[model samples]
Target: MRGPASLQGRLSLWLTLGAVLLWAVAAAWTAVHLRHEMDEVFDSALEEAGQRLLPLAVRDIIGREEDDSPDQGVATLREHDEYFTYVVRDAEGQVLLRSHRADLGVFPPFSGIGFADTATHRVYSDAALRGTITISVAEPLAHRWDVAREALIGLALPLTLIVPASLFGVWAAVRAAMAPIRRFRAGIEARGGGDLSPIPAEGLPSEFQPNARAVNLLLDRLRRALEAERSFTANSAHELRTPVAGALAQVQRLIVEAPDEDTRSRARQVEAALQRLARLSEKLMQLARAEGGRLQAETPVDIAPILRILVADMGRDAGGRLEVSLPDAAVIAPIDPDAFAILARNLIENAMRHGAQDATVRVSLSPDGVLRVVNAGPVVPPEQLARVSRPFERGATDAQGSGLGLAIVEAIATGTDGRLELTSPATGRADGFEAKFATNRIETK
Candidate 1:
């Protein structure tokens, strides 16, 4: 069977995906903004350095041209292991000074003060020294990219750790929120077979209260409907019993008093019809009682004696066609004595009524609280087997039956916390029907 859908799992998946997307967008924006700000800061430092060095280059060239060459002027500019390199050129396009890190030939001859790019470095030029000298500051492009990568890693690493922790918290919160639903399900599951009472609504979450109230309303309607049905069946059956019995008696008297054979035969037919009606009415009463939601007795009752009594009673009419197998020891179970008797009688009677005339009916009760009845007959179709336990349904159309036998037995089984199973071609019998009842509690001694 397919597994149940998980609301928590779906919610968690969406939440985690949304969180990841949000984090990714935020991280991307932060990286972009950080790189822009770093570029601005570094560019400003480059411009300031070029302006400062412009005036110094003019003073050094005019005062010490004899002793300080362009290379010596460049050596004097190295103050720290910073990323910038500089070159100073005069108006005549002669190199007046150059930093050690500067690629001498790669630095293009200056045209005006601005920024430019070579193969490896970004260069910014200034011509603010005596309005003639130009100083260019250049740095490797790789340096700026390295700094941006370090800054992004520092920002993203902590967030990566936090995402998993946040996902865990979301899972826990979802489970906690769903606890009320689980409790509501458990309450419904704990009800007894006949419990159609309104569900309790207190202590439930506000969001679930409306659903709970609706369920309670449905239960209330079902309870009323079932009560009406049971009451009507019981009252109608009771009211009809006296008249039916009186009619059967009158018909029998008519049969006895009839002078002609034809009249006597007609009276016997009428008596049979009256007898079928009487049996139908009686079964209706038994079905109502079985389904009346009455609490069964908790005391243990031995089923062996009941079986023996039922077998003997049925055997009178069954002649030599009935067989019974009962365990030597008593098989005791918690059940209502009246209900058990009704359930057993219906099963045995059904088997006898529908079974082949020459076929023997077998009744057996095991120590494990299983009561089984089997009888030789044509195999009942599998499709019809399920419906046979419902009211007014029969295995064969020609069979003389009220059709409430199996239904009444099923009702009693459910009320007593027992199970009823029906099978065609009864175990070890090629062409027969079997009915098995398994009680929840059984004791053998």
Candidate 2:
């Protein structure tokens, strides 16, 4: 099966991804804009330098023909200037004055008066000395790229560190915001069947208050419905007890006073039927009590005496078919005395009724608060066992039962926070049924 997914984890993941994506887009836009702005500033500087060299080139041109040699004045401008070079040409397109670093022997052939590009450099040409002189200022494309790259790196460095830190902050905030939900879940889980009070909405976030209120409304409805059902069951069982007992007493009298053998036999059958009805009524009362709520007062009760009394009562009917194995000392557990007795009685009675006629039924209590009733009988199928704990369900259709025996026991166990385990064919006995009760705490004294 796939594992459960977490809301907090998914929210954090998507939030972080969104933040990273936004940051990347912002950074890319900044880089593009920064590169464009740097190119403008560098290009403007190139044009200004060419204008300053125009006057110097005019002076050099006038003295050039007299000297018939290249000027040395432009040589000093080349020093410590790796990113820019300049070439001044006459109107005839012959080189007039050039920087020492301008290694290209021929000046750029003029087509117009603006920026142009050769294979290695970007050239800006301007007419100076009243259009008599042409000045070209060239910068290598490699050097221009280096300047723009440095500006882009300076702009991006801080965001690279900020993005990871921002994501971490978002995760922490999300977890802290979800703390109230965790508290709400824990409060609900801690409640028992007896706790039907509405959950308090105080101190919860506004976003969660509606959910809390809705749950409280549901709990209120459930408590009222359960109260009504319990009231009906208790009143009905109480009302039937007196009438059922009166009828059973009348049947017993009929059996004793019948004048004919057939009449007496028929009266005896009626008595048996009345007895079964009485048992069913009693079980219904017990089930209602168990389901009403948790025990009001829990007291340490010794189970040895109770178990012995139950086995003795059952043995009268079971004769030699009953067996008992009690712990040497009393087993003490926190439980309701009436509830425990009812649970044990139902289990022993079920064993006697369903077990093979000649097979021995054994009732045993361990020092650790495990009470077990085992009897030789057909094993209950696994599929049926899963559902047999429900009311009015028996191991076999032919078995005689009110079908509330195991259901009552299960309810009692749940009220005391105990457990009931059923196994068909008790260990080492292939044709036996075993029912075990495990209380929450057990003490032997």
- The best candidate by lDDT is 1
Worst 10 residues of 2 by lDDT: 70-79
Backbone clashes in model 1: 1
Per-prediction CA RMSD (Å): 4.9, 4.9
**Per-candidate TM-score against the hidden true structure:** 0.77, 0.76
- Model 1, position 170: C-alpha lDDT score: 79
Error at 342, model 2, angstroms? 3.2
Compared with the true structure, what per-residue lDDT tens digits does model 1 show for residues 1-445?
A: 4422797777766787788889889999989998999989988888888878777777777788576555554454446766888887777777777877677766777867778888888789888555577788898888988999999899888777877887788788988988878777777776554778766666778988989988878778888888899989988988889999999999999999999999999999999998898998999999999988663666888878988998898789888888999999988888888888899999999998898878898999988889999999899999999899999998765879999999999999998889999999899878999999988878788
Model 2, backbone clash pairs (residues 3+ apart or across chains), number: 1
Model 2 misplaced stretches (Cα beyond 4 Å): 1-10, 45-82, 85-121, 125-137, 140-168, 187-193, 205-208, 296-337, 362-372, 416-418, 425-429, 436-445
RMSD of 2: 4.9
In candidate 1, which residue pairs clash? 74-98
